[model samples]
Target chain A: MENSPKIAANPEKYTFILFVSGMSVKSGHAIENLRSICDTYLKGNFNLQIIDITTDRQSAVDYQIIAIPTLIKTGPGQPRTLLGDLSDTEKVLRILDIKS
Target chain B: MFNYFHKKNQTGVRKIKPSKPQDEKFSFPKTPTGVEGLDEITDGGFPKGRPTLICGGAGCGKTLLSMQFLIKGITDFSEHGVFMSFEEPSKDLSLNVKSLGFDLDKLKAEKKLVVDYVRVERSEIEETGEYDLEGLFIRLNHAIDSVNAKRVVLDTIESLFAGLDNQAILRAELRRLFHWLKEKGVTAIITGERGEATLTRQGLEEYVSDCVIILDHRVIEQVSTRRLRIIKYRGSTHGTNEYPFLIDEDGISVLPITSLKLNNEVSSELVSTGVPGLDTMFVGGGFYRGSNILISGTAGTAKTTIACYFANEQCKKHEKTVFFAFEESPQQLIRNMKSIGIDLEKHIDKGLLQIHASRPSLNGLELHLLTLRKLIKDFKPTTVILDPISNLITVGNENEVRSMLVRLIDMLKANNITALFTSLNKQNDNLRPDLAEESVSSLVDTWITVRDMEGIGERNRGIFIVKSRGMGHSNQVREFVIGSKGIELLDVEFGPEGILTGAARKSNQLQRTVKAMKLQSDLDRKDREIDRKRKVLEANIAALKNEFESVVEELGILKATEDLHSKIMIENTPKTKKK
Candidate 1:
């Protein structure tokens, strides 16, 4: 997966797992917003795994998720979690340690 | 903890039907809350493998009760539990129960318990579309699975409403969550905020859980009391009264007032009242060993003296005794009893007596009873004495005092401990009887009335046995004296005037003595006159005999002269005639 041209260009890899409640409007919006931010800021240097908590409940629990549509940045230093629909893009980037 | 859950498949579909009244075939198993008196009212405990709703206002011990349930489940029942708090963080929760001797950190370290804090910030969350509490479910499930918990607590579940604006979705998700907990076969406690009109603020009680318990904190007459009541239980018969509960350093303890039955074991042994004369007034020397005694009287009529005597008697027997002096301090009670020839300090020094002296106004009546219960349990006393229960009447109303005393007496009787209670009757209302005496009279087995009988220019103390069940006792009122030598019952004086006491008794004795002396003098005079008459008759008889003897002597001389004239030849015949 790392051999793709988009991921091979950058040495700094940001790994994230976004837990969502199925395909609800809020979960879908949170996933889209997080992907857009990653694509715009990281320039294909990040690895994001989207998990539907309704189906993959174990992964959600393993991350101690408490709110639906929660985004967790697990790599590149300390882990940080942002709850809700990820509507505040600036706060999300700051929490994920994304350089503007 | 993890290893135990590995043996059972996590995906097993065990459907838990919401218990219905008509479902006679299935009985919900109880989970023993392990609270002191809670299990008795809950019919062993909350419904097992079902969600029980506990709703109350703020500061009503909703969180403390849940914490105690979890801690007791882990320590007493050996059942692991998970505490998921939505209000206080895990650190605050642990620190709060530390005063109750619950080491939550140690339990978590031992893997027997798990504490998870779920923070739901209203500012951080924006609900835009349809969503579920799947994230909460996963977190709770993980916590439970980590400890293989048999009990689960969600403290303040209504806090989610504060963070989410979608009430319809929140309600639906909450219903699913309760059902899921039951399906998992774990006893769960879900606490909620009380509503103004409904049982829960968010109408959470509509979910039809297995049980619903409501806690209330109210201040009546400037005294605060916490009460617990079971709003509904699906399958079990439980106490329906609002039981008073206490939250102290030992956590929450519900006082089951009427839970005691009349089937406690009874003993036929008798215990002395410490006064020898008083013992004879009782049929079997004294009262029954486990029976309750009531000493009701007016002021300064020796009610406390009697109670102190009973306590002294118990302690002298090497039995533990606890004396609750509500009106006096320990030093004052000891000193007062010392003046009455009863040395209570010795028993206290020997460790056989425990004096708990406090003002009745210091706390509510329920707290006093709880304190007595705790002391009795710790000391294991064989005898308990409450000096002047009338003082307690100041703290509570008539009904509360009656209920408290009834529970107190019942507890003592159940433990087979002898109890003595003193009550003070008013001076003017002595003939009418006091309220305390009238209320507690029926509960006690022996009723001793001590009153002041004022007669003949002095006040005298009189004691009488009003009632003694199962034994014959003295029916006559005996006047008693209380001095530095202690109490002594004088014999019943039966004079023409009635029962005499004080100066009347002394005057009656004096009158009887004077009458006896006068009668003795009259008898002596009559005996002298009779003696003189008999002497005179004897002298008259002596004179008559002397005269008759002289006549007989003359006749004998004449006959001898004639006989001598012819006696020459008839000497032999004269001798024969003389013979």
Candidate 2:
């Protein structure tokens, strides 16, 4: 809700959906890493939705998720996917086309 | 470590139990793949509940083969399957196989199959940190559970290597994946791209070690052939030879060339050789029911005519016959045979005969053999004829042709179907059997050779039996004429210049008739002379008898006169004499 004003000001909305398979360490780390990056860099200008594929497998299939802790960055640019736990924040931001 | 957490996650998910017990794993059980001729080669099918590596080059039908396995599994065995394609999406995969009559959507709707296409694009993803392929595991688990699948196909799983970057993680994951599939108790097929040196580009053969099959497509002399060979199979004996396979409208069919053992059942029955004279040459009056007959001859020696006669005879007996003509087209053969009074078209219409004609160069020797095999399987004919198998030599060398014929004859013999093959020998090699004839002569049960016996300024066709196994046969050469009615064998004519035929035989008959007429006239003249002589002698004898009688009467008169004069003295003398 706090990122609403920024979301309207910036027409390029960073829509991110993270697909994970359960409450595993990698999934938790990936979710935390993606949130921290969005809050710090795109503050109030991004929308993030986390999906647990173990519970909602249809979405995992819809996103074509193969590796766990996968973050798909859609809208504002070409849709790109970041595999693994998103531990390398700099590389993820670069691949997602986010300017620091 | 990550492995410990993986174990906990797996246990927490569903308390999964491996399908087979540890001790029972040694007992090999197979799930039959419904592909024709495949089960026989594999000794059964893929090792059940384990992964099989199918490595092949591009466009060699690797994906199609795996798709068939999955579809056939569901349709034929009533076993559910999960197809995880790593290259093509589900829709494209379905469309690609639609022509093959695999109704993937219907199977999916019926809850008998699940198609999960795992699209991996390198440009779309960036590897950040250490990642386990737990997502793939979960998705596969979900699909398997949804369909309750007993079969799984990960077509071209080697694509994962190009999608991911970290070698260590991918290797560990692939190793685990095969193990997981085995633990899941589902028969799985993992396809891989052929490598230059190794069986698979990623060395997937190292991971899935239970069974490995290599599919190859090689083009030689502009003719392409697809072959399949089993590199290794644990716990079971399998055909190790490279078996040629075909991909047609029906799908892939592997032709397992040799049945290996010569244990086919034999039949004592006999089938007519179509030519009545040719049949008489054999003591059995015909060829053995399941025997292989070879008719080797020079060109224009009535070899095809003889073959047509045999085919006509079979059709007359209401037996199914298949004639594979390599030199002539079907219409041409039917027309040519019609000249010899053989009606092949009628038999074709009646569905009792099938004339499959193709140029020997149309396909590779293996393809021709496979086509013949498929025809025999579908038609289930009681008799098969290959007119002029010598034409096949143009497509392959002598050894290849001989081997193909061996397999073909073996197949026919095993099924108790009588087969006949006509071979054309070169004109120069008239004295001895040529390469083609000698190669096949030993394999045939009966060999009949038709040759041109050159006579004085003319040539005559001589038909004789070279060999007839298990039966007595005439050794004399019989003259055969290809007339409008059919092939007719004439009686053996022995003349001063050996066996005569054609014009020589006719002229010999004429000379014998002339000689007999002259001798009969001479005998009639001698009989007249003897009659004349007998008449003259009888006349003379009558005259002599008259003369003798007259003389005897005179003598008796003289004796009477003397007796009268001497009667007085004779009476006295007689009394004295009597005293």
Candidate 3:
């Protein structure tokens, strides 16, 4: 028998608002990274709403997010912010203190 | 081994592409499943450009996992998916997951996904020689192209084997089917029935596949463990252990507990155990949030009470709760519990609780599981209760309930929701619920037992903590009494007599017999008090008699003095003074 994966569903309320600049390398990586983080780290209690500058570049400025791959914790806790592509699972999971 | 890049968009269209091509790069593309533990087990997700086999025994969470993977892909990854089921109808799947809040039908209508259910009955079709899954391929391609799909799922393709008797032709066709799917170059999940000698009966899938995930449900002693393992994954470093998996309303969850990594970071706050006495027994005085508790007891021993107490505790906390009453009717159960003072009416009215009571006989074991799964999916309760899953024996006997409980546990654990369950044991001498029969005990993080121990000429209902996975707990059976204040537990009285019972109990009834038995000190005090009262009465009588005698003497003196002449005046005066 193979060992099982440690999978858990999150209970805290959370949503993510992403500010991306166009569908560039960083933008695509950011979306994938955010999704992967949510899948492996956040499970289902979190949602991600993306603002793509590909068509609506002005909308990114409205959120005042200076970085291209900025993640805003929209719903839960004190305003937690993560900058850069969400490729770091451990850091992201730690920042959120996700239930292990 | 996968790299994804977004397309440079001139207008509004979004393009999704993988950095590594199928043949040019040996690195396998991964389809990340949005489910927590599943991605870890698969080392990312299902194989990106090949058919991943998910073979399992009946009621082993095959369909659910595939659906979860598909839904996660479409909604999270922007990779449109096509769900082609060979067993269940699209309507049933939609209805089943409606509780989970996944509107697959809506996803299909949105042109982002496709749900096609193909019905095949062996009795209906007669096959000659050559057979092809060409129709399924065409339908799948159409659905995929419509959404520019990246994911596809075929549930229980073994239906084709049972439908067609030409074993050689079916085997050949099954091989061809996987080949064609691989040619499609889209991540696909193919569910199959467990074969007697292998992961799949056809045996062709494991021979030529990018990945093979096997799901199994088995009873080890009395505990049923539903395990999922990566039998083979060609190009990825996948977890090799047989991970325990659960299928509930929110779908399949594989708990990858490879170690005893304890986290004291548990919520320091306490939540009541529903039973006042039980909560008081805890040092923190309650169970932590997301705790899994088991109440095991013989029939008529109030396992249901413990569950009710747990639910009541949650309602008191002002948290929403979902009660899956598989044994009793909501009204019948509520009315019966009124005798014990468990008033669920107010909680239901307050919108803090939802009671979903149903007869296990109403559906097959899977349907019942699906319904519970749906309830949790839709209700999203902080706590869930299953009253006497032992009654679920009517649905699938032992094997089915065990499997169902395994899934049920996984679902609750994954959601971080506290779950309370009551399991009935028919035999008095059993240590646990016919756990072998139901096989659910081992999966619980905590176990509580309630039993009717013959004592005090009646029955002494006692509840004891058998085990707790993490926190330290007491191992004493406290006397459980149902009062207006809810269930109260009496302190466990320990002495040389062990547990008091029957005539011994009667003899030790000091409160009732104290008046009957006169103690020496009390008797002595009563005698002294009586003696003192008698002496005082005697003294008073004697004084009255003396006074009367003195008066008579004085009168006699006065008469004598009067007879002797006026000289008696002095004597009369003297006699009067004496009187």
- DockQ winner among the candidates? 2
DockQ of each: 0.28, 0.74, 0.01
DockQ of predicted candidate 3: 0.01
Best by TM-score: 2
- Candidate 2 per-residue lDDT, tens place, B303-370, comes to 88888888889999999999999888899999998887889999999999999888888898887887
Relative to the true structure, how large is the alpha-carbon lDDT of every model? Answer: 0.84, 0.86, 0.70
Clashes of each: 0, 1, 18
| Tens digit of per-residue lDDT, candidate 3, span B1-579 | 011112113111311123235467545568897775788777678777788888888988888888888888888888889888878888999997778778998898888888877666545333221223433444565667768888889887777777656566556656666777878888888888888898788766666566888888876444455778888876567789776666555667666643233332344446788776786666567776787787887777778877887887789879889888877888977887787888888999999888888876665555565566666787788898887677777656575567667766666766678888887777656453475324866777678888888754587688888777666777677777777656777765544567543344445555336744666668888999999998998998999999999999999999987778866666668876887
Sort the candidates on lDDT, descending order: 2, 1, 3
Model 1, range B338-444, lDDT digits (tens) per residue?
A: 99788988999999999998988888888998998898889999999998898888888899899999999989988999999999998883377778998899999
**How much DockQ does model 2 earn?**
0.74
Question: Candidate 2: misplaced stretches above 4 Å?
Answer: A1-12, B1-27, B522-579
* DockQ rank order: 2, 1, 3
Model 3 regions more than 4 Å off: A1-100, B1-27, B33-41, B51-75, B80-209, B212-231, B238-265, B274-284, B360-378, B392-416, B429-447, B455-457, B464-507, B510-579
| Quality class of the docking in candidate 1, CAPRI style | acceptable
Instruction: Estimate candidate 1's alpha-carbon lDDT, on a 0 to 1 scale.
Output: 0.84
